[model samples]
Target: MTDRREWPLYEVFVRGKRGLNHVHVGSLHAADSTMALRNARDVYTRRNEGVSIWVVPAAAITASSPDEKDPLFGPSADKVYRHPTFYPIPDDVPHM
Candidate 1:
């Protein structure tokens, strides 16, 4: 049998039946992607709450660090056009 310690870490994302996007659920160590996906489903969706599961190898993910948030995201703060504050919402708009 393969050693558990040799397994690679995986990040799990699960989409609930009522959710429109896949949310990061948790992480696990698995021998491969298939096993990671199965383990994620079993661990995170035991109650049948999730409709989809995605497992990505931890090393495969590249994320910005919180410490660098200002330098990375600060430029976007001055882009006022990105915000919809100037628009008036109509009553007929469902989610607005």
Candidate 2:
């Protein structure tokens, strides 16, 4: 008997060579975790633009919608100290 259930959807993240963070690249449907990883690699890193890959189930991510922007991120606006403008960045800092 063939399994008829739909494959789970996975979100793919790729970290470029000089990147400090993993950026969301795309999504794919896979039967299992291993397959998801492999598929993500083939689909997102085909040009070797990424040095690392991450795959997370689409259902696992929690995102705030544009309509909720004020309520979700409004608190940070009042915290001026967190802006990092008080510190002077050294000219030697690469990619800063």
Candidate 3:
């Protein structure tokens, strides 16, 4: 016997009108990719809050473990020059 719980799980991302990037919203289980997208829209955007939606199979995502954050991000921490703090913006720049 097959359990419905075995249905593929999908991760949902929503881009709100005010947001510049898509943000993780929630997860849902569906039989296929098309259904997953429709289900994500119906479930996560009930209030019409999102301008865009993305649905990816949970199994397709490769994520770093939370416990390994320091190890994963440590190299970038010492590269202070990577940040634009030293750059002087012209007054003409609107969003800087």
Query: Which candidate ranks first by lDDT, i.e. highest?
Result: 3
- Higher-lDDT candidate among 1 and 2? 2
Model 2 over residues 1-96: C-alpha lDDT tens digits? Answer: 997989999999999999999999999999887899999989989998899999999999988899999988998889999877898889898764
lDDT per prediction? 0.91, 0.92, 0.93
| 10 residues in a row with least lDDT, candidate 2 | 87-96
TM-score list, all predictions:
0.78, 0.69, 0.74
How would you encode candidate 3's per-residue C-alpha lDDT over 4-61 as one tens digit per residue? 4678899999999999999999999999999998999899999988999999999999
Give every collision pair in model 2.
none
Clash-forming residue pairs, model 1: none
Indicate whether candidate 1 or candidate 3 has the larger TM-score: 1
Off by over 4 Å in 1: 1-4, 78-81, 90-94
User: Which lDDT value does model 1 have at 82?
Assistant: 89
Please state the error at residue 79 of candidate 1 in Å: 4.7
lDDT per residue as tens, model 1, 24-81: 9889988899999888978899998899998999999999999999999999999999
Give the CA lDDT, 0 to 100, for residue 56 in model 3.
Answer: 93
Error of 3 at 31 (Å): 1.2
In the order shown, the candidates' Cα RMSDs to the true structure are 2.9, 3.8, 2.6
